[model samples]
Target: MKAGGGDGGSSVSDEEWERFLRASLEGVPDAPEEPSARDRAAAARRPPERAADTAWRAYTPPRRRSRKGWYVAGFVASVALLAVAFAPGGVTGLFGDDARGADAAPLAPESVAPTAPPDAGPEAVRPTLAEPFKGSPAARWADGPAGITVPEARATGWMDRAEVARALRLSRDFLVASNLEPGVLRGERPAGAIALINPRQRDVQDYLAAAFRSPGEANDPVLLFSRFDPAQARLVGDVVKTRGRLTYAEGEKGAVRVTADVTFVYPIAPAGGGDAVVRTIVRREVVMSWDDPAKVITEPGTFSLVSYRADMTNAGCGPATGRLIPSFGGGGGGTASGPAVDPYDRSTSMDERMGAAGDEECGTATRS
Candidate 1:
C-alpha cells in the first residue's frame, strides 16, 4: 500500500525524510581516525576481539552532529547539513573539493565501506556526554512513543470511524508497550503488550509467552521487544529516538488492517558508568487486523497479528541469549556475515531487506 504520514511527522514530509536519510548515507569516511583518550580508555576495557568483532565495529553510529546549544539546535544542524549536501551543486563544490564537470548532485562519500569489513576497532568520533545523541541523527527523532504517530481515523469498507480509530489506538498502544516500556526494555516480559493481542490467536499468544519464558536461539524475545542485559549495559540517556508512520486499510471478514513501519534508535552505555555510548537501530514492520466484534466475537481492544517483520542494524545479527547484545567496542556476540548494508539507508523498503519468507540470514550492517 502507498503509505502516508499523519500530523505526527508534519514537521517533515515523507519525501523529505526519505531524501534526508538517503543523502545522509553518502559521505561516510573510510579510515578510522585517531581515537581520543576517552575512546582509548573505553576500548581498553572491552574484551579482546573475536572473529565476529568486525561485525561490532560496523555498527558504529554516524558522524556526531556538533552541538552549539540545546538539542533543538542540534536537530537544526542535521537539517541544514541535508540541505547543503543535496543542493544543486554537489557537496564537493560547497567544500571546494574536486569539481564534477556538470552533474553535481553531491557525489557519494569518498570513503564508503567495502562489501566486507576488515578486523579492526571502530573509528573514534566524539565522546558520549550528558546528551547521548548529541552527535547523531537521532537527536532530531521524537522521544519514545511520541514518534509512533497514528493517521487520521476514518471509516474503511465495513469498519466505522470509531472502529478505525480504536484499531489505530490499540495498535499504537501495543507498539509502545512492547518496545518503549522501561521494564520491557530491561528484559522483562511485555505483559502490557501481550494483553492487547487477540487471545483467539492461541498460537501467537503461546509463541510470545514461550519466547520470553524460555528465550534461546530459536525463540528470541529481542525480535519483538528491545530488551537489554542489565548486568552488561544500561541506557546512556532516558530518551529513545523514534520515527515511523502507521496506516490502516480494509481487511477480510469485516476487519481493518493496520500497518506500522517504525525505526527506533537506542543509545546504551556499559553497565555502571562508561565512556563509550553505542546506538542500536531497529526497524519493525507489524501488520495487525481487528475484526468486527459482532462477526468475530473476540475480546475488546485486541487485534490479530497478520504479519510481523524487522531489520536491526548495529545490534548483532542474532539474539543468541535473547537480548540485544550491543558491542560497546570490539566485544563478541552472534555471528554476522554478508555484504555491508547501511542501516540508516531507508531507500529500500523493509520487505525488500527481509526478503521472502524462509530467507533468514545473518546479514552485516554498514553503520548503526
Candidate 2:
C-alpha cells in the first residue's frame, strides 16, 4: 500500500504508530480488580463516610446544654429525697432502737416505773399541845366547865412565871396609883385605870366608871380608895404599897387564866368629914383572851378580860366579901341597906360600906 493512497487506503505512518504506542505504555499502572460481593456488603455496612463523619464530630466541641433544664431536674431529685427522709415511718424505721448499733445501752425496766417515797404514818397527823402548858401547874385546873379545849392548848403557851408575876405587880400598882393618888378620880373617867382595862370589854369600863359614884352604886370591889364622894375626896398619905401572888392556868376559848391574891393600903379624905387609911386584901381570878402577840406588843391594851371574880377582905372594915363579874351577864347594880357603918372606916369592907350607904348610892348586888 502506498503511504499516500487516495480514498480508502490506509495512511498510518510507522513513526506515529510507534510514538502513540510508546506514549500509552510510558507511566500507566495496571487497574485494580473489582471487590467480591461479601466485601462490598461489609463495606456498605461499615460505611467509611459515617466513620469519617464521627471522627470529625469528635474533634468539634459539643453543643452547650440548657442551665434551667438541668436545675429543674436536680431540684425534682432533691425534693423526692426530702420526702423520703421526712415520711412518718421512713427515716425513723431505718435508725430506730431495733436498728441501733451494738455499742448502744439497752433501757432498764425500772426507768419506766419509778419507786415512791415512804409514808409518814399516823403520828404526823395527830395534834399536839404547846410546850408551856404541857406539864405546867395549870394542868391541875383542867377539869372545870371553862376547861381549855385541845384547840386552845395548841393556840398559845401558858404565860411565863416571871411574866405573870410582873403583870400581877404592875396591875396592883396601877390600882393603887389610879385610886389612892389625889385628883385621879376627879374626871368623868379614871384615866389611869381605864387605860389598863381592856377596851373590848365595855362592861368592865362601865363597872370601873361607876366606882367614882357614891358607895352603893359602885359594884367593882377593886376600887378601894373612895367610899364617900370620889369627886370630893383627896389623898392624905404616901403612895399605897401593894404586894401580890399570882398563878397562871389555861381557860376555854384560848384564854389565859390568872389568879392573884393582892394586898394594898388605901388612904383618903372624905368629902363630908373624916380621913381614914384602909388596909385591903383581895383574891382575884380572871380569864384573859390575848390579841396576836405582834398586835399586843404595839397596843398594850389588846387583851380582853373575859371573866373576873374578886373576893375581898378588910380586917379593919369587916368580913370577906365577894363579887363575881361574869362576862355572860350584865354588870351589878345598886342594892338595899343592911347595916349602919362609917363610910371612911378602915375596918369597913366594901360590901358593908355599900350595905350601909343606901340602894340609891351603891349599885344592886347582881351576884348571889
Strongest candidate by lDDT: 1
RMSD of each: 20.8, 65.8
For residue 349, what is the lDDT in candidate 2? 25
Candidate 1 is scored at a TM of 0.65
C-alpha lDDT of all candidate models, in order: 0.54, 0.26
Instruction: Note the residue pairs that clash in candidate 1.
Output: 27-109, 64-135, 65-135, 90-106
How much is 28 displaced in model 1, in angstroms? Answer: 60
lDDT of 2 at 366: 12
The CA lDDT at 91 in model 2 is 13
Model 1 agreement with the true structure over 1-368: per-residue lDDT tens digits: 01121212124443453454445323223322211111101111111222433433534333211000000000001112211111111011111112111121322221221233222334433326355654344555566666666788999956789878878877878788777776656765565676666654534544554454455545566666777777677766566767677888887656798878777877777776657767777878787777666655345677766666667765565334667767776333445443345554444455455544444555555455
Report how far residue 258 has shifted in candidate 1, in Å. 0.3
Candidate 1 root-mean-square deviation in Å? 20.8
CA deviation > 4 Å runs, candidate 2: 1-173, 177-182, 185-188, 205-234, 239-243, 267-301, 309-368
